[model samples]
Target: MDSILFIEIESSYKAIPLLVFKRDHHSSIIKKSHVRIYSDAHALLMAIEEQVQEFQKLIEQQTIQMIEDKERELNEHISHLQASAIHQLTLSQQQWFEKAEEQLNKLLDAQEKRLSEAIADARNSMASAIRNRLIKMNQSDSLIGYLSDALHAELNDVEKSLVIVKSYSDNGTTLTIENDDCMVSINTQELLSELKSCLENISDD
Candidate 1:
């Protein structure tokens, strides 16, 4: 017999499926044996997660490089504009300004799209990992804490530029591990490390 348990996070939360098995049976013995298998699965998941994070970081780095190139082009255009501004403010200067503005806008849009896609990919992977942890711990009473530790380990290996973006209610907070030069006060990486340590301690308890 297959038993399913559905757990909901909240009213807006989707229910997750977990298996149930009766204790003191042969199947229960097999369940205990499966601990080793789950450990193996955990290792495999971590490897896969590392590869995925590497790929994401590569993409992000490439995107940043492309942005830097675009910024150089924009700077050149601005310089040309400034030079033209010194002249009689001709129609040709207006045309150049319009074209430069259009290109800048396009580049900005593309950069934003790339960032959004990368974040979405990370979120999906994280959610899948959480689901797998829950499924593996179906019969265990203390699953959340264990899963939290696993996530912390995973996060430790991720790039400083990428952090998990989660939504509370309808608002979203992007917890970036990278330091932004624009905002010196937000030391997100340190904050995340402390948070992970707390979660791991909870898991140990």
Candidate 2:
């Protein structure tokens, strides 16, 4: 085995090579002194130490750079995730609103249909009641007699003679009075029209 010896120079605070020793097969130690060889060896060791320090610094710089790149990538990914989440939430809210509006429109349409049916039923019931009442009045003999007397009073001044007639049919009643110069007729339809107008006026009041 061969061994290298190092000695420190107090002026430069650097380690310099001093001697090389080796053992022969007989276990005898031999020492060789060569100042130029030892100086070259010391310079080589210093260059190797400098290279190792430079490599360590480079590794530290690369590590820092890698950490920064990873951090930047993570931040970008987080931002993308947040943007996607917001878009999804907005889409969900829009869908909910559309569904709610559709339901509301259907509800309103159903209510409108029901209301229209109710109005139609009420109109039919009222018309039937009016028609039955009018039929009863038409069958009464007292009503015919009263109408005749009223026509006689109205036509006293203008007529040579007046004839009054009462008629009843499925459509309703008709009252007719005729003279030589003029004729007048009244029907249940005309009475119904007058009654509707009066009812509208009363509602407005």
Candidate 3:
């Protein structure tokens, strides 16, 4: 693969859309057809981290090899030019040296630019992958059914006249419940009925 990648998927029952990783385009095949599967936040992140380490090591090795090869090539070229200049007219040989020097300089500049661009592109892709991984990791995995049931039960104890409700998330539950009815227009009977209906629906499920 040209790049290392991972995938994650999430589905919700409350008409919520399936959540898929924003990145990851690697392909696989099964049964003569392509198949794409999902991974959790933890596994996806670990894969990315491992890929990053591998890329760094590859880059380092390539850089060392390029440097050594370029040095040896330059030295050989310089020696050849010096030998030719010694048998030629002085002024003619000076022009050859200048031309060769400029050529080498241009070659070095081009190589440096190419390397810089590749590294920058790699960094941008890695950042994007890491960002997506973190978002998935932070997302809560509690089922929507569980959350709805729990919230409905808690709302039952709240008075009908109350306009605002708060639940702490420190214990992994934080929600805001709002009662639109004013105190003067409080319908305790209707609120109790609604709560009962919700409970019954949960039991049926």
Candidate 4:
């Protein structure tokens, strides 16, 4: 009779698809098989081998289930974080863009206002200059006529025979006159200055 015994068995797996979820392809399996006895063994040894295979299958199934759950949870968490970050970035960019546009519009408005004022000032200054030039031109023509007419009219008027040429200066107008009693001489600038002083004193009063 054989007192010691030896036994051998095989173990493997076959994937089974779970059809519970319509959109997700999740897979799980419940393995079941009759042990094939390769060599005759004692009853005690056969029982131990069966228990070991069952234990191994249960451990493998539990471990794979845990790993799949953890991986799915991790992927979902990462995707959520990425989406949240993108949303926050978009919001921040929109806020900054609005602020920048507002500031730019304000600057443009201020610049336009300054430009308008400057253009108005330039127009006013140009109008003033043109008016002054016209007034000065009229005054100059009148003064020239008066100076020439004074000398010509006085010289042409019939009086006496004697004639006198008066003093001359480069700064102002010169006049010549002849009369019956005495030919008089005068500087018109001094007379005009005295007349202007008298008018100014009257205006002050």
Candidate 5:
């Protein structure tokens, strides 16, 4: 069934005018259509959320790169220092080498601690910032607008014969149809769908 319909086929008639309103077809087409619409909406939202997760992954990759760079630089510095100390020292290997090694170890330990703390602090701050940004995006008015925009695009041109208008207002978010015979009013929030009083005409008499 089309998301919007302007006419219905009656027996062998062509282009029979139809006024489909809500509260009709409760057990059938309307229910399925509502479910389909919501499912599509959820899929789109998840896709957008995946982008956020990808951004977090990028942050993690950059952090790891920074740690690797720092470690490489520190290793090069330590290697240079150890070589210089071993070559320039005047004392015997047993005494002077021992002292040089001890001092170098002390310097390496201090430098490693500093680097670890800096990386830890940076990672925490970056992760916190990402979470905060995502929270803001989820909670802000932007989310509503995004939902409206995405819904509009996702459910585009549902029916060529019917004119559909998506509106967002203080009252509610709705999809309205301009049809001479049938009026489709979809409360995008509640998203209830049905043909109004369609069962009233059913008669056994």
Candidate 6:
């Protein structure tokens, strides 16, 4: 039988040992035991470091995913806002154009009405002026004929002896009678005036 030594590690609050090891009487194996303990401790530390690195990679990946999601959300929001603004602008422009067109139509209608009225007034004025001119022309022709008949009646016997001359001026019409002895002048306007007064008196009677 080989001589063996037993060692136990325990906490102060527990009666059972947390760890147990068996040692043999080979003095040279004790050094190998120390080496084994160091190797196991180093392996555990390596595993723990690897686990920490994996955890760090996981945290970095989660952060990157969160950042990407936030950027996507922000981009979508901006796009929505731009679309809404464009729609609103289009509606506003349409309304403005419609209003402007309506106003322009109204202005055109009013201008057309005014032009028509002005044209009617001008035509009426021209017609009245032409009618008055025709009446005046008729009256002047009648007056000239009456004057010629009176002159002929008065100088019936001396028609060949008398040289009669007629002149027109802005003030009135004039008649000149010339003979070997003297010349006579008569204003046709005064004769016409006296004739008009005689006609008026006869009408009143």
| TM-score winner | 2
Q: What local lDDT score does residue 91 receive in model 3, on the 0 to 100 scale?
A: 68
Clash pairs for candidate 6: none
> Rank order by lDDT, top first?
2, 6, 4, 5, 1, 3
lDDT of 5 by residue, 36-137 (tens): 565576688799899989988999999999999999999999999998887766446667789999999999999999998887777666655654554444
User: Comparing 1 and 3 by TM-score, which wins?
Assistant: 1
lDDT of 6 by residue, 1-205 (tens): 9987643423431342223224455542333465457557668989999999999999999999999999999999999999999999999999999999999999999999999878766765655565455436433866666666666556562444565677887646787765555655667657655655554454344
lDDT by residue (tens digit), candidate 2, 4-24: 766433454234322343335
**Candidate 1, residue 197: lDDT:** 59
Sort order, TM-score high to low: 2, 6, 4, 1, 5, 3
Q: All candidates' lDDT scores?
A: 0.54, 0.69, 0.52, 0.59, 0.58, 0.66
lDDT of 1 by residue, 125-145 (tens): 665565555445443424333
Residue 147, model 6, lDDT: 61
For model 3, the stretches where C-alpha displacement exceeds 4 angstroms are 1-88, 140-205
Give me the runs in candidate 1 sitting further than 4 Å from their true place. Answer: 1-27, 31-33, 89-205
Positional deviation of residue 198's Cα in model 6 after best superposition, in angstroms: 36
Q: After superposition, how far is residue 80 of candidate 4 from its true place, in Å?
A: 0.9
Choose the strongest candidate by lDDT. Answer: 2
**How many backbone clashes does every candidate have?**
0, 0, 0, 0, 2, 0
The predictions' CA RMSDs to the true structure, in order, are: 60.9, 8.1, 56.7, 17.8, 67.2, 14.0
| Model 4 C-alpha lDDT per residue in residues 1-205, reported as the tens digit of each score | 8664333323431221223213323522222222222222335577998998999999999999999999999999999999999999999999999999999999999999999888777766665565454435333546545654565556665443444454455434445566654454445555455555554454344
Q: Give the range of the ten consecutive residues with the poorest summed lDDT in model 6.
A: 12-21
Candidate 4 Cα lDDT to native: 0.59
TM-score of 4: 0.43
lDDT of 3 by residue, 43-155 (tens): 67789999988998999999999998999999999998888777576767788899999999999999999998887777666655654543343324333234444445455
**Pairs that collide, model 2:** none
